[model samples]
Target: MGSMAFSKGDRVVWNTPQGRTEGTVVERRTSDFQLDGQKFTASEEEPAYVVESASSSKRAAHKESTLTRRS
Candidate 1:
């Protein structure tokens, strides 16, 4: 796959304009999809993740490379 080894409910962190943010992995999207009116490209080799922000509970889709597994 595309190194998106995280499973659903896994705690993860990623960088954002506001700085590092933490959240839980809600789903792994392997096909192209739209979220929040934004397009996201994904594939079996380069998957995208639907993550729910721990602080705001806002959901956003992000490429696997942008996410880091957290404890």
Candidate 2:
């Protein structure tokens, strides 16, 4: 995904095991990271977004291609 950058506090939606979920973008992760003992792969060319769930407040990392910025 090129030129798709999301800033912190941005509202976004993504698909999850429970179906579509809404959340706020916590940050952009260009480097690999581990959260809650789960490893996430990321790169500048294909960055991942760390987001906080709106309903549960749970945090998870998702690829940019998987996220849609909410208006």
Candidate 3:
């Protein structure tokens, strides 16, 4: 897998149950952390992005491979 390259405020899109959802890159997590009692293993080589959905206004974490940067 490729490394994470997204930064805060970056426009991105990812697949969802309904369809493709657009969002902004809220933060980049490089170290291991937990969210809502769920453990997330992240590192410099495999980071996770915290994104805020534009339509639902909800926040979620996602891997870089699952996101596509908007032009």
Per-residue lDDT, model 2, residue 22, is 97
Candidate 1 worst ten-residue window by lDDT: 1-10
The TM-scores, one per candidate, come to 0.92, 0.91, 0.87
lDDT of 3 by residue, 1-71 (tens): 65449999999999999999999999999998876677888898889999999998888888898999988
Residue 66, model 2: Cα distance from true site in angstroms: 0.5
Per-residue lDDT of 1-71 in model 1, one digit per residue for the tens?
33458889999999999999999999999999999899999888888999999999999998888899896
Q: What lDDT score goes with residue 28 in model 2?
A: 87
Instruction: Tell me the deviation in Å of residue 62 in model 3.
Output: 0.5
Question: How do all the candidates rank in terms of lDDT, highest first?
Answer: 1, 2, 3
Colliding residue pairs in candidate 3: none
Q: Which one wins on TM-score?
A: 1
lDDT of 1 at 70: 94
